[model samples]
Target: MSVDPEIHWPIPPKGGWTADDLDRLPNLPPHTELIDGSLVFLSPQTLFHSRAVSFFEWQLYHQAPEDLEVIREFTIDIDRRNRPEPDVIVVGETGCPDLNETRLPAASVLLAIEVVSEDSVERDREVKPAKYARAGIPHFWRVENDNGRAVIYVFEREPATGSYTSTGIFHDRLKVTRPFPIDLDLTQITAKRRVE
Candidate 1:
């Protein structure tokens, strides 16, 4: 949650934010994402959100296949107007881009995950999923906090319409085979007060 407060933002160009614009911006704090040509500065994560992300970060990293990598807060270039920074991404090692690069192409991505914050409800539920689906990302996962309990909703892409269909909904535990075999006890994820 240690984000820089100083950022000199410019008036968004008549054209929405594109990959070229992202390259031109002066280095601002991390977690800046471009959506529809506008700079979407993410709020510093809250404890609830942070714990969930950290839990998954470890889970995904250890359980992922040797050929795939699990990363967090990385941007995916969805298209001309959308580059979303997903909370957790599982991408193929060979398809992965340089780690120093800010954006990864959708083709390299196997999964896109968003852990919803109160501020991100509408965007997570609607905007991002639409963009990822349009970009043909094969899988998407949304983690929701309901009364301090985490509920994971899984989606798989529908090739015909570039949309996602609800594949599973998990609460107590997550056991899935797509995007790699993963078996996580969700109770341990949200119940912990500290990450370590």
Candidate 2:
């Protein structure tokens, strides 16, 4: 598969793409990410990925406190050369100022969640959590598809070490207290919803 030449793809500078370059890049594919000075173009999302993200987005929004906000498909500027977008982020109330904002600073993001797609398994499982932890994001969740079911791996950052420790792995339901008490039924992602 060849990239369309008409699309203006910017050449990386000497050190490779910076976090700010993402804003100026022309015709970059949606959800494009930068990792270790390299551009990562995401593959098309699968139905399972889409549904799981939506389910978590809705659940977090409803459960979050008045001072926190939930967002989906947004990037956090981790450093000069890395700005990977988590599938969902739970941010401080002031994290996003306006609807036009493209990204948030890592400090403002409280929790970053990634719903694993086949193409993003390694990154979601390993790379992203490390980046989020190093950036001082307090919490992280990795949602994996286990035989068509959602399995959430919850991690809390150890402030002393600046690393994430797995608090628990929740399959049928997710119950956590650190990041502002959240309880969700993992099975709801695959449950039927009534459309009015």
Candidate 3:
């Protein structure tokens, strides 16, 4: 896996950190997230993780429509104590692009992606999905780093249940028409990532 989150300290919110407290936090970690009213400080990402995220961000920007913007390590205010920072967020042209906005609404987010790390596998796969589904995000993409390569998983929300339905898994290339046509060659990207 490219990244592995060790949950530096699984500090619970026994009247601990609130969203307001989080906002007041002087030196928030580079990529801190609030999960189920608790604080989970993720471990630093590896070089491979940075390369993969950069690759995706670059590709999304190049291939996406003019209206779409690809952002990295962006945060969304989920609840009072549950703010999640997805690895990559694809949103429509938000007018306030200049500002370093603290949070983004769910409606503005078209797709949420999480590059699976060894320590965050369950959270990325099971926990985060439920939240994204409930937030009414149309699509979700999960990239599992396997020996420097990625196995892609795509899911679409089931409107009735506010859950997801797996579209398919891609091992070679990711070809999708929804959420604005995207055609990415995973093999080539991962190969280049390994060399870096």
Report lDDT (Cα) of residue 85, candidate 1: 91
lDDT of 3 at 166: 98
Residues 1-196 of candidate 3: C-alpha lDDT, one tens digit per residue: 5545744543545765665566666656767888887777788777667767777888898998988888888777666766888999888887236576777876788889898777898999999989998888899999887787778899999898889999999988899998988999887655553443
Kindly report which residue pairs in candidate 3 clash with one another: none
How far out, in Å, is residue 174 in model 1? 0.9
RMSD to native, candidate 3? 5.4
> Candidate 2 on 1-196: residue-level lDDT in tens?
9988777767778989888888888878999999988899999998889999999899989999989999999988999999999999999988988889899999999999999998999999899999999999999999998998989999999999999999999999888887898889888898778999
TM-score of each model, in listed order: 0.90, 0.94, 0.86
> Which regions of candidate 1 fall more than 4 Å away from where they truly are?
1-7, 193-196
Q: Which one wins on TM-score?
A: 2
lDDT, candidate 3, at 21: 64
- lDDT of every predicted structure (CA atoms): 0.86, 0.91, 0.81
Error of 2 at 114 (Å): 0.5
lDDT of 1 by residue, 1-196 (tens): 7656675557777877686677778865688888888888888887778988888989999999899988899888878888889998988886665657767888888998899997889999999998888888899999998888889999999998889999999999999999788999888766746657
